[model samples]
Target: MRNPSLAPPINRGLILRDFPKAEDTPTVQDTNENDTNWVALMVRVRDQRDKTAFAALFTHFAPRIKGFLINSGADAPLAEECAQDVMTTLWHKAAQFDPARASVATWIFTIARNRRIDMLRRQRRPEPDDLTWGPAPEPDQADVLALQQETASLSVAMAALPAPQRDLIEKAYFKDLSQSEIAKITGLPLGTIKSRLRLALDRLRHAMK
Candidate 1:
């Protein structure tokens, strides 16, 4: 493994830009210094159980994981909690990181993905057996095409929305908050929140067609 001290400083901007960049970004050799190989850092963590290496890894990934969870519909507090859990798991399971199979970012984000799913499932109340969901139906060609088209249109429409509407939509869907919750968070009336959502959905639907 390469010495951390000799590695180039890790670019925090690149690390946050995309997880794939983690595989390509250099790691910091010193916990106090900012340059090193990520793969090497993981190896150090695995072979020596190096706390510095683990700290370096945490510094790089924790906030990104939290943002990812938040973007995937988790609340801020839940995202923070899940991100911490993911980092702790990475520290303990560093030996399992396989550079050949995936980059360090991919591996870490996989853990984040799984953790988010588990958190969401836990948040959902258990339903009676009779109300339990069954296997989902496979999408047919037309349905698949229509869904794809709608997704593309919605993307465009969302980008075109005024800042206020866009922010509301993000809070409602991206943050997975209800209208009431969004109203409370934004200090808007419930009626105003509902009206904005309706307008946004209308524009999105029009764009989809």
Candidate 2:
């Protein structure tokens, strides 16, 4: 039940059943926990120029953020650079920290993810816009979870639909074809394709709700 963020070796130990760092990690914070509040530390750093507290938090969180990147397949140097960028952001945006919205670690990781992705995109620098369709940016954690939820919802919705409707919806979205395209491919009338797609989407919407 511990926060996975605190255990840098969890990814390394995924093949095993146990992780030692996890032993010292807490499962959850108390509602009123006040000691070493990261949000408050940022506020003090911003308003009172409290470098001491800021340094402590930065030192603790930076390596953890770097681990997240390295474990996700980035090289050590890139991860460290991204980690530094994340901390620089913390310094500049200290006044913007909101404890209620996310934990300090989550905020740090989100910054790291964005900065790392930006670095990667710049490094790859996809072909000129005219030469290629732009590559999609990798989704952050929130987007990934939202996509997974959408997949799950779609699965359930598809299951709830009568088989024929699910098939139509699949052909429409997953196959990325127009109704007329699907009609031509499936040898059905365009009107029938449109009707099936509409009815299928309606059922999916209701089922998802």
Candidate 3:
């Protein structure tokens, strides 16, 4: 049977208080010694289910995770909930941690980032009952014509763009890719992605006007 003590702490307030303020949180860029220690702690949690190691990790990372979520636009309550979820996931998925690919802080922060994204997506999703099942309304002819004209103008503007800028814009809006994802796919630096997308958007805006 699983030991009850191995379960994550339920007292969140106490956990939050254990760490220093978010601004003081150590990042992935911290000293190599600290990073190496975190890796060892994670390995202990994975191989032995060591509660002491888990507690130490929790004490160090919980506040940092919470702060990261808040900075990513999650409110306090949501950030706290997501931080707890990230820690719980860490306990369960310790075996999945690949030290060769990423440091402990990077893995933990990635989980927190994904958790916040999932929560935001759930909040923005429309309830099934709120969806319109049948839509039979006919479009107004004038509105349809206006839309067609606007679409044609947009197409022309898009075609006029330099290939690189247009490609980035298409990936960003049409493919719904994050800047980081776009950078990886295009083999471009992240700053280049942002710069091209910004320039592309500015031209498109001016063209549409």
Clash totals in order:
8, 0, 0
lDDT of 2 at 22: 20
Report the CA-based lDDT of candidate 1 relative to the real structure.
0.57
Candidate 1 stretches greater than 4 Å from native: 1-36, 123-209
**After superposing candidate 2, which stretches have Cα over 4 Å from the reference?**
1-36, 123-209
| Tens digits of per-residue lDDT for model 2, 1-209 | 88866866422211111221222334212211322266567657766778897898887788888887775567999888888888989888765554333346556766676676577665533322321211122213343333223323333333444455446645553345686655533432223224433543354346446
Clashing pairs in 1: 4-29, 8-35, 26-36, 27-35, 27-36, 27-37, 28-35, 28-36
Kindly list the per-residue Cα lDDT of model 1 for residues 1-209, writing each as its tens digit.
99987999664321111221222323311321222266668768877899898898888889989998988878999899999999999988776654433346657877887787679876533433631222112213343233323333333334444566667666664456776666543432223224433544454346446
TM-score of each: 0.43, 0.43, 0.47
How do the candidates rank by TM-score, highest first?
3, 1, 2
- Root-mean-square deviation of candidate 2: 18.4
Every candidate's lDDT: 0.57, 0.52, 0.59
Range of the 10 consecutive residues with the lowest summed lDDT in candidate 3: 130-139
Q: Lowest summed-lDDT stretch of 10 residues in model 2? A: 13-22
On residues 1-209, what C-alpha lDDT tens digit does candidate 3 reach at each position? 88987997664321212333223434312344466678679878977999999999999999988887776668999889889999999998786664433457767966775676688776442323511212112323343233233323333344444566656655553345786766543432233224433543354346446
TM-score of 1: 0.43
How are the candidates ranked when ordered by lDDT, highest leading? 3, 1, 2
